[model samples]
Target chain A: MKVLIYGSGQLAQMMYLAAVPLGIQVSAVDVGNHTVVDPISKRSLELSIEDAIEQADVLSVEFEHVPEDLLEQAQSSGKLLPNSEAILAGADRVREKAVLSKLAIANSEHRIITQVEQLDEAVETLGDKLIIKASRDGYDGYGQWRLAHIEQLDSLKNTLSQLDLQNVPLIAEKMVPFERELSLVGVRGLQGDIQFYPLAENLHHQGQLHVSVAPAPDITENLNQQAQLAFKKLVEEYDYVGVLAVEFFQVGDSLLVNEIAPRVHNSGHWTQQGTDTSQFENHIRAITGLPLGNTKAKGKSAMINIIGCDDYSTDLLSIKNCHLHLYGKTVRPKRKMGHINLTGKTYSELAEVMTTLAKFLPIQAFPKLLDEADKLAAID
Target chain B: MKVLIYGSGQLAQMMYLAAVPLGIQVSAVDVGNHTVVDPISKRSLELSIEDAIEQADVLSVEFEHVPEDLLEQAQSSGKLLPNSEAILAGADRVREKAVLSKLAIANSEHRIITQVEQLDEAVETLGDKLIIKASRDGYDGYGQWRLAHIEQLDSLKNTLSQLDLQNVPLIAEKMVPFERELSLVGVRGLQGDIQFYPLAENLHHQGQLHVSVAPAPDITENLNQQAQLAFKKLVEEYDYVGVLAVEFFQVGDSLLVNEIAPRVHNSGHWTQQGTDTSQFENHIRAITGLPLGNTKAKGKSAMINIIGCDDYSTDLLSIKNCHLHLYGKTVRPKRKMGHINLTGKTYSELAEVMTTLAKFLPIQAFPKLLDEADKLAAID
Candidate 1:
């Protein structure tokens, strides 16, 4: 079957690779070029976006930021999965908050604001230390405004007023003093059979994922169950039929929903080497109405993102438990260039290798280096 | 750089897949097609054999059965490795015996015969029960004659006399009652840097690899060391500069060399999901002069070949810790269609998975099914 994915990024590239072995043809829409690139055929062709949408058996997105008009067109084609509604919830902070609140899921209290005048009430209700997020087109720390005090709120409010919040809307939420961040990636088939991967502890630097360790360390059984329940609730509530990633902030024994991603996610990269079914393959299975695959961990695995750097220590390969995966992307500053996957017999052993890896990886380029190091060291 | 492989089978296909992520171009010579096919580019073109050899950066074979003329031409290009000399040793039973004897490697006693008249001496030297094998183009139980008793030796000799043994020399060997079969897959670079993957315990059915377990079970430290030493000796002795797989018969604590494969072998398939570096990727690195990757096992892993039939239990994907890798080939009887990989916290867990997989797989087509079942059950 033919699958069409929106956005031609590393995720799309990997998904393309996964699909090929299953004899599934995958084509990607380069949103920048408004053209389609057949990953298997390596053939580029110009076609109307609607025609491409109609031609594919399934339409999915690599990320949540596809233009709404194209998504609407794809929805009209009756093939867009997790569907535009689910993707919109992920794309817009307001919709995401509403979905969480509607499901009685814990999240930071927030107010949807469209104009600068509303910022006064937002700050009064949400408090001085707050996070202002554009409801659309924001990722990797972009389109976010953080206020540390009341005095800074005025300038932030003015900055927000100057932007086109009228077109996108905004979410001003109280800053959460989270102890750590974790994520639950689950797949839901069309038959509503859902499979949840173990919660993954994630460390981010500069708002981009730097490292993800499967079966998050020191996680209380109660809190992990809560996260899985919240994830299941969201998937069933939305009738989501693909992999859904729910980001959470751990506070003592409780977890608060931080965000939701309606497709295969970065935090789940460890599954490629650690799990029986990789998130990419499971996503394909979920979307194709095939049986959801086993999500059990193969071993303790840690994934280190190779951000914005083309040159990596080939010597990492010399380490006893490191697997280097270089995404075929031209390196650019702060861009996700590739990642290294290290699997070991135990979490502590994996952590030790991660420590060795940090020595060779540039800390400035990868913001979560110290955090990743600490997590690995603390795994025991 | 462009690499041209001499055979278009699953190994070459996998190599092509691995090369794509590295942005390397790969084309394969399909002996069946008598032409070259670009695996990724999916472009098929005809060219004079000489032109194809000259166009490649290096020439390698997927199997050892390349026509003598083609081997000579490729060797004349001065890029064939581990060289025609090493390949001939694998291809010709006579040459293989000579190499083993010269190296003082432990192998079954054997004699070469060019005519039926020599059979009486061969029988006397080797024993009553003898295996007569053609020196060239014999694999998977083909091109061999068996003598169960001394009385039958003359009839076998008479039957062999009808053929021109001069044109096709045969090697007679005493049957070995090996305890188990094992293999060590290692890679050597031109600069003499070497890396060894852990020894693998292999179970074959119908003369085909049915299942392979990494870090061979019940392996004593001394035996493991001996296997590694033997592998190092063979690779260094041959000046091998690519992946060399040395098969052995583990009789008690000792290992008798069975044969050597100059390229990636089936027993190493567990590396795909079990190792820090897959054999396919490491072969490319060793051949390309890149730094060798770590050969550490991700976990205790078992690889089960999906032979003959195309249909197998997709249910294996539902079981925890199972990876289904289909080769995207149309299935036919006795054809190697694909394989499944299972990785677990321990060997016993891997064995459990292998047993569970066997129930879903058609063991009748593969001769080693019962042995695989026993091995899986012995995982503890």
Candidate 2:
């Protein structure tokens, strides 16, 4: 079977690796434009988007932010998985917020603003401390602004008034004091059968993900049930198919929905080491109408992102149970060049392995990792 | 770093899959003649073998039976890993027996016959009941003859004299009444570091491997130590620098060395899902001078060969913890198409899963699977 992916990135490359063992061919379109690159071959072909889409048994996106025209064309072929609406919902904050509201799921308090004048009311209604996100094309701390006080609104409004907001409205959210961030990566098959990897605890640096520990160290039955309920509601309502990653903010005992990624998310990378079948294989299985694989975790796992550093050694493999997955990318500051997944028989062992990993990573790019190591050390 | 493999078969393809995630490009040379084929691209390129060897950072063989000229050429490059001698040892039964005797390892009582007349002494000295094998290019059940009694030896000598035994000599052995067969797949790094996976119980049909169960259900520390010690002797003597699979025959409480494969062998396929890091990845690491990953088994495992069968369903994936690996080869009777690796948290659980797998497999191709399932059922 052949699968076509919208983005020729690490996610697609990983998918290619997972699919090949199962006799499936995964081809990725650069989405940087029209051209399909077989991630396995790293070979690019001058193929039209339509031609590529037509060749696949199923069409899926690595990221939700694929071009609307391409999504529309793929949808027309009836091959687009998770559907265009689900992708748009993930791409735009407004659609995402609406979807959460319809499911009666808890999210940060927010209001939509289309003009500079509405910013003043949004500040009053939501709060002075707010996060303003552009409804579309926003990610990794980009296309967003933060407000700390009422007095700051005018300058922010003055800066905003220079541009028209009607085309791209702002989702003004009242910042909440939360405990920590978590993400649940779940796959819903075309038959509507659902399976989820254990929720992964996420740590972000400069608004980009740095590291993730799966089965999120301090999880409870209640926490798992809460995430499952939200996932069930959203997937059922949208008739969702394929992996959907939901980011959450934990406040006291309650979990608030933060964002939805309509494709495989980085937080779930630990599945490569910790689960019976990885999230990539499950996503491929889900999207291709194959039976969903077992999501049973084999052990505790930590996935630390290798940001911008290509000089790292495979000496990390010397650390028992540490597995390195290097994405073939040119080095650039803060870019996710690769990730190392460390698995252990127990959480403490996993934590110890992560602590050892922090030694090999640059302190400048891995302060969070160091801090996490310290916390794990305290427990030890 | 790039790795050039000697064979463009399924083993090279799997190594290609494992290496790509570690940012390594593996170019496979179809040793049937001189040609380099990128297993992933499925594209063949006509390149000079010398240029290919020089281009590779490391050279390794997928199988041990490459042509001597090719091995010699690769050897001169100072890159052929595990070395040409190691490859030749695996290829010829005579050399293999010599290595075993040099290590003082036990083997079935055998005599080398360079001439047909040696058959007369072989029967008188060794025993009447004997199994004779051509020292080179013999595999599965081919290139073999049997003499049940002394009277039969004259007829066997008469039959053998129909041809010459100059280039291809025979190893005639007094057949041992063995209980079962077992194999140990171990990797030796450049730094002399070594790790061994637990012995795998193997079942053969028509002298071709059928099914293998790791941590061999009935195991004693003595049996494990014996295999490890023999492995240590063989690898140390050769200064081996990659995965080596040693096949053994069990006689009462003792184990006799049957054979050694100098590359990733079919018996180690269980490591793909059963261990922290697979034998293929470890072989890649060993040759590249990278740190070896852990060989710790994640669980009990069974690897059933998918020989000559392409009509198998992915429904095997529906079986919990079952992983399908198709070689993408055209079906032919007795050809190794691929394998399925099934893992479980315990021996009993693994037995149950293997039992379930037997249902999906053709009885003709997998009688051992049925027998194993019946045994497991009896235990249940």
Candidate 3:
């Protein structure tokens, strides 16, 4: 089978790696350059986008922020998985909130704004201290505004007025004081059979995933069920046919939907070594209509992201149970370079390994560094 | 770091997968084709044996049967890990016996013969009913002769005399009735630190590994320790660096060395999903002077080879805790196509997954079919 992946990035590279062993050929298109290249052959194939789509058994995107025209054209080929509706919901916060609301899932109360004048009503309805987000092309703390006070809301709205809100709308949401963030990575097949990986507790630094621990330590069975139910509702509503990552905020015993990623999410990286089937492979299986694999956890696993820095302390290799994965990416500041996965039979043992990993990681970015250090040092 | 692998097969392909994540470049040359190719690029590059030797950071082989000239060239490079001496001992039965005798390792008593005249003395020294084997280029039940009676010995010797035994001698050995077969796959670094994976109970069909279960079932702790000690002794004796898989036979309470593979062996495939560090990554680490990885078994694992068939029962995918890994090889009869790795908390659970896998695997070979069925049904 041949798969055409839009966006030539690390995720696409990894997908290519997973596809190869399945005897699937994957070709990538760099939408930025409008060039199609075979990842394995490193051969530049001069073909029209229509020809590429015509040849592919499936058309997919590495990121949801693909050009709408390209997605529409690809969709016209009747080969795209997770389809344009799913991508739109992932790319636009307004559509995402609407989807959640339609499903009656718990989310932060929010209103959409097409102009600066709507900010007054948004603040009145949601709150004075609100997060004003651009509906599309927003990620990693970009294209968003924070209103600390009612006086500041006007200036934030005024600043937002200069941009073309015609192409993109604004979503102002009430900020919730959540204890911690968690995510559920689940796959739904074309047959509507849903498989949920264990919920993962995620830690982010500067709006990028830094660390994720699977089975989310101290999670109650009821909460897990609730989360899974919420995920199923969203997947069924979308008629999703691939992996969907639903980010959540744990407010007391209840969880609030934070966001949804249409494709495999970084928070599920722990599943690569922790679960019987990796999220990447499961996503491919779900999209291809293959039987869903075992989602059982192998052990307690933690994944630490290697962000921005290309060079990491090779000392991490010295850690007995750690598995380092470096994406073949050229380094840049704040960019996700790769990740390290550590597995242990016990949660505390895995925590110890993560503590050792934290030292080799950029300490400042890892919020639990000091606590992890104290805990690991105490063990010795 | 760059590694030059001598054989191009599934093992080399897996090693390539593991190396890429570590940013290690592996260039492989198939001895059969005598052509070098970069696994990642899939590009065939013309390289003389001398140039390959000169350019490599370390030299290793996926299989033991590399040509003597190429082994000598690799050894002359002064960068061969586990060295030609170790590899030669593995490739030739005569050399292996000599090494075992010198090390005082328990092995079947054997005699080497260069001429048909030696057959009379060989039978007198060993036995009339003996296993006669070509000293080199023999594997997977090939290049071997079995004599049931005295009258058959002369005819076998006469047939053997037609071959050029000048380059390849023959070894006649007394057969031992063993309880079961086991293997220890371990690694030794240049720093002399060694890490041993848990002993594996192996099952072979037609002299090729069919399945391997790690932390060998129903074994005493003392026996496991003895196996580890034996493996350590071999590693130290060879001054071996990189992974070494030593096959053993259990007779009563004692273990005898059967054969050794100087590189990663097929029986260690369970490590892919059942260990903290896989054999492939650890081999790269050991040879590259990187710190040895943890080899602790995560759970009970069973690896079943998918040989000679491309179409398998997809129902196995529905089995919990079963992980299928197809090597992307174009199908052919009697060829190792891929393998499935099954892991569970208990041997019985792993056996259950194995049973499900057996139904999917095309059981063309009688020995494999019977053994798999028996293993599956006996697991209750």
Q: How many clashes in each structure?
A: 2, 0, 0
The best-first sequence of candidates by TM-score reads: 2, 3, 1
Q: For model 1, how does the per-residue alpha-carbon lDDT over A1-380 read when each residue is reduced to its tens digit?
A: 77899887777877876776555667888877778875533456466777787778999998998987778887888898888989988998888988898999999888888888888898778788888888888999998888899888777877888888788898888999999999999999989998889899998876889889887878778987899899888887878899999999988888999999988899988887787678988888778776788887867888888888866656666676676666666778888877888887777788677778777776667666566666666657
Which candidate's DockQ is highest? 2
> Between candidates 1 and 2, which one is better according to DockQ?
2
Per-residue lDDT for A61 in model 2? 92
Q: Give, for candidate 1 chain B, the lowest lDDT window spanning 10 residues.
A: B38-47
Error of 3 at B172 (Å): 1.4
List model 1 lDDT by residue over B239-357, tens digit each. 88888898999888899887888888888888987876788888877776667887888678888788888656666566676776666677787678788778877866776776777
Provide per-model DockQ scores: 0.38, 0.76, 0.52
lDDT of 1 at B37: 74
Task: List, in the given order, the native-contact fraction of each candidate.
Answer: 0.46, 0.81, 0.65
Error of 1 at A366 (Å): 2.7
User: What tens digits encode model 3's per-residue C-alpha lDDT throughout A323-374?
Assistant: 7777666788888888888887777787677777777766765565446434
Q: Positional deviation of A42 in candidate 2, in angstroms? A: 1.9
Per-model i-RMS = 2.9, 1.1, 2.2
**Which of the numbered candidates is closest to the native, going by highest lDDT?**
2
Q: How close to the true structure is residue B16 of candidate 2, measured as C-alpha lDDT?
A: 91
iRMSD value for model 2: 1.1
Docking quality band of candidate 2, CAPRI definitions: medium
Clashing residue pairs for model 1: B205-B367, B205-B368
